[model samples]
Target: PDILHQLVKGTFKDHLVEWVGKYLEQVHGKTGTKNILADIDQQIAAAPPFPGLWCFPDGHNFSQWTGDNSKALMKVYLSAIEGHIPDDVEHTFHAFLEFCYIVRQNVIMDQTLAELRDALAQFHQYQEIFRMTGVCFDFSLPHQHSMLHYDLLI
Candidate 1:
């Protein structure tokens, strides 16, 4: 499967973006303290505009996502989610995004290779936050497993 299409726009969008929303709702729904999802949407929409980065005025609420949209959202997602979620969940996303950016480089040196392994390892270590929070019962999804093949690709 193509990394950009399958992993970036597909699995990450569904699991991290959408499921994170669901997780936030589940966490905040108990006390009815505030609309955490809406807060997230607002915070994302209010993200300052920069030259090349796309501004998510509507946040991640769109009905459909183009490839470019997914890529752009990835740039802002970690920051938008930083303080709102648990540290482990943030670490999971950070590691995944780190792996994504690192693998995108055209030149993969020995250091980059080692970094890839570390990033993927960190991702696996923290991803249990999903199951722990009940956002996912299992990480059995097909697209999710494809990232494990990156080393073989080298």
Candidate 2:
């Protein structure tokens, strides 16, 4: 199901990030949103130097987001949003990142497949936060639908 564009890029950037931003604004008014988002940006920008990881000085405020950019952001975003957002919301992103990384593995074992299934389940469960928060009205998106088959495909 075109994991790169559908699962990684679409799910993470188009959906989750956008939903989280809206959720933040919903919970915190305009001013609070700015300060909280700035804190997230600072956390992202301050990510320690790593060989392959790229830094985002402006967090996810960039104009364009590619598959690579989303993948890189997944590496650090969970930590950045840990305390700022609800535990359910944080765990939803956690499950998503876990699912994405597990799917990206070149060689898949049965145990990993089980883990993949569990992560997907957790993601679906916690993702209700978006709907409940009114950040997103529907999650019946093609990319989300595609995720249902990822475990079977592997």
Candidate 3:
């Protein structure tokens, strides 16, 4: 679970930054994705712990990273990117989150083929996740979970 947790956090953080970057760059034409994410992360990190709530711009309280509200975190992240609520991003964001939930649930189910298929199907929506992460079709070197640990520690 610890390894899986780390992979989830590491991979999704990278994915979050990349996906947000692509979306913003598409809309605003070469916005600084790295700077934006860094600023947002710093802002979130610097919040004063009062009432034990991490208040985002969209009003979601980010208390935990791993839970039912993981998708909400992604939405908050997207909101941070543009400093505005996206009109139609909610549905797409929810779909992505649902896919992540399915992946996590499948891992818990001990490698069932049905769950694997569902997870793979959802991957189609995440072309950016794959492209930005350099994940290959075969999930080989410089891709795949096998190489994640080495890079993550650095």
Candidate 3: tens digits of C-alpha lDDT, residues 38-74: 6666555445556535445433234655633443355
Instruction: Compose the digit string of candidate 1's lDDT tens values, residues 33-129.
Output: 2466666668789889898788878877888888888888888888777778999989998999998888788999999989999998998889899
Model 1 segments beyond 4 Å from truth?
Answer: 30-34
Q: What is the clash tally of candidate 1? A: 0
Kindly indicate the candidate among 1 and 3 with the higher lDDT.
Answer: 1
Model 2, 4-62: lDDT tens digits are 88877889888898888899999998899999999998999999989988899888788
Comparing 1 with 2 on TM-score, the higher-scoring candidate is 2
Which pairs of residues have clashing backbones in candidate 3? none
Give the alpha-carbon lDDT of every model. 0.81, 0.89, 0.43
Best by TM-score: 2
lDDT (Cα, 0-100) at 139 in candidate 3: 32
TM-score of 2: 0.94
**TM-score computed on alpha carbons, candidate 1:** 0.90
Candidate 3 CA-lDDT value: 0.43
- The 10 consecutive residues of candidate 3 with the worst lDDT sum are 145-154
